[model samples]
Target: MTKNHNSQHKDLMLQNSQKLDRLLTRLCKRSGCDEEEEHEGGNESVLFIAAKNGVLEILEKILKDKPGAIHETNSLDQNVLHVTVENRQPRVFEHLEKYLKEKELWESHVARADKDDNTILHLAAKLSRYKPRHIAGSALQMQWEVKWFLFMKKKMPHMQFLQNKSRKTPQDIFVRDHEDLLEQGIGWLKSTSESCSVVAALIAGVAFATATTFPGGTQEETGKPYLERHPAFNLFAFTPLWALFCSITSLITFLSILTSRQQPQDFRKDLPSKLLVGLSYLFMSIASVLASFSSAFFFLLRDHLQQVVFSLYAVAILPIAYFGVAQSPLYMDLMRATFRNIPQSSNRESEKLIL
Candidate 1:
């Protein structure tokens, strides 16, 4: 019976998309259960397998077939809710909440404790045993980590003060489990900041030199720029000024990342948020430098450089695009998830979105 159940679960996970009714019948027959009986046993049940593997379709079908299975526990005595949180399955997490509420099992199962006297909140705190690639990278990975811990904390307020069998609170477990990721995060942030600082310093130097060299030379008498009245010269003057300011701002922010205290809380909102702002400023500075260079180039070569304009613009965009494509996902994810007022759940399903 166990062998048959494992085989069926493996097939379902492999995406053998039979109708729920037909699949249930086959599972019943293969396991030697009569029609209309819920498949039973820990880890062997369809519900537990679906929750553990993040197969939301199979989970929903199992729930509809045997709503009681929503409360089923594995060898560790954790229900589907606990498994979903521990697995960090976003889609299953969202759908399960709705299912639990419709069936009125939120309180019984959500706060339900496992064998170690650890609730779903406790499971959420431990560094995941399974890492999903959908999370992008370590920076965003840590952000989502904090986000889930906070979500679970809010969902179960009493969980904040609750201690498990080991006598450690959820916060303690969270801080401890995340130690390695936090160090990795710090390394990522510092390296990112260091690289940006170099780029910013480079821009500052180029902008300074461009201003001193004065695109079309200076007037012999007044020491004024020669093309002071031309619109392109106005662009040349304004863009470098903007670039210099932005790069300086970026440099300061990245410098702060270098000096920030690498605490667990720092990863939550302090260091990462500042890194996001720094990256934004650096991006703007790079854009400003491109504009300044193009405008100055036009001023210096108006008579000779008309044909090469398009090619030159394309060349300038390559580096800018490279930096953007490489870093935009982390920036977008951090911006969207951090610094927001997350709504708390009280026996109600909160609509969860992927970061």
Candidate 2:
């Protein structure tokens, strides 16, 4: 059986090599033509052939001979690597590994999508027969995952399980036969607890401070009050002191969260990024809450246009806030759970995205 498998692989390799050589000759012949020189189509044909054949040796030589060829994109606005993954050609991935190793391509190799905006992994996960050529085992899989994840994590981490053009996720395609793996992923996310205590505390502080508010010459104004009066969005009513209290509370919560994560030996390393991310989220959330509250108040006061605008703005803020808070795995899990219930919408979005 081993001999037969080896012999088959050898035959396939020879056939592929012969096909690639013929393709190279044809492309070389066309490279000098006026029609080929007129557009990117011919250049793409050459790259597609090289990438599809996993002909890294020839590709490297071409790159060395004409570095400008590396910058070309195909008809669908994809690089050679993108075409390789799109075709589910493992040889292309093998060639890519060698190319990246020699040239540190990650710095220069920007991911371009097809008409559907699908990333390489997005294409791979959808391809049932796709298996990385040179790379093998969990090591290569994990490496690719990390690289792919890092590339798209910020924009759409939840997109892993989300369906794409082919109505599948990389997770779905990769783990189609493994129910346990799917369950494990969902279970891990669901287990992470959501953090709302700080937010609740901040809101409570706002309410308390609002209750303590008094205008000038009032009884509380004579005492040392928590906050002073500021011009409200509505000049008709006295401005609440809640914003000051909420801001202070949120700032304290942010600091506390930062402090808890700090290590004595490596305090500088961890604390700054956490502080920045946390504070940015807190400020944005507080501002949004204030905007929504003001909008609601104005709506009650019959300011229809302002109310509509503010309400729309508030609604738009939810996804952004979700992203800001998604550093908390629990919030992300909640989003996942919520999204799971609306699979039809998710699939629709995926289809639209693929389109």
Candidate 3:
């Protein structure tokens, strides 16, 4: 039933896409102008709308039908690249970039400035009006913004230092525009660090106590643990020390985050990397501490109450499972945002647009 429903949905979308294609073709023919040509008044064209909304299929179709439309600019002198970057449409931008580079028009198109003398780099530096649905937190969002600016900077090296009409360079615009976001990111990082650091500290303290006091009392003569010969002894022996080390490492990492200068550049990699490391160590510590407790419980109850040992193991797993499920999304997001590669235009020829 689920597969059938999904199939039906996909078919519907395909049908809708076909109808849209036909409508666009007819409109282009009737108007006797390309997709980017203005409508009756000064309203934006269909091509501009598609680029802004990241409707890659529509944009691709239009570009294929009328290649010259790629050069047309709106009243504000903003081209397809400007629209895509301002609206945070990475896919569309990538497609257009590849198309332009293939045509050997990359330098000319990328160097175009709008009415305000704001280059594509300047537009990239400005924050988009829409919030990114994929990135969760404000801090991660800031990280993406910085990453995008840097990506555009690399694409147009000469334009990076060029000032706009307001006499502000792209970097200057970025700093001025993202000041509030930077502050919010700092606050978010500090709060997250503070909360996680407390947990790490508590785990460290517990692990230290457990490591000092072995599961079984020591023999008076040899001063060796009575349970040293037992099978679970190795687990009980190793896990607490591992837990202590991991928790201490987690604590230090979080402390670094809390104490970070948190410049805008830090959001690009440094801060997120630290947060990822801290969270990773914290998770390892939790698992290790739970394993130590479970092993100790299993050893104590193995001979007397074997059934209780299984129950103890199950009980020990519950918290770790809960923690994993609860924090998995955040951890995954951080990992992706911290280490994700910037989208690059591919060398392959652009995919043919099906009309």
Q: Name the best candidate (by TM-score).
A: 3
- Off-target runs (Cα >4 Å) in candidate 3 are 1-18, 21-41, 343-355
Off by over 4 Å in 1: 1-42, 336-355
**By descending lDDT, how would the candidates be arranged?**
3, 1, 2
lDDT of 3 by residue, 138-193 (tens): 89889989888988888789888888889999999999999999999999999999
Q: Per-prediction TM-score, please? A: 0.79, 0.29, 0.85
Which candidate, 2 or 3, has the higher TM-score?
3
lDDT string for model 2 (300-349, tens) is 54545654775666776686577666555433332332232111101222
Count of residue pairs whose backbone atoms collide, per candidate: 0, 0, 0
Q: Higher-TM-score candidate among 1 and 2?
A: 1
Candidate lDDT scores, in order, read 0.74, 0.47, 0.83
Between candidates 1 and 2, name the one with more favorable lDDT.
1
Per lDDT, the best of the predicted structures is 3
The residue-by-residue lDDT of candidate 1 on 247-266, one tens digit each, is 89999999998987877656
Candidate 2 lowest-lDDT run of ten = 341-350
Model 3 per-residue lDDT at 125: 94
TM-score of model 3 vs. true structure: 0.85
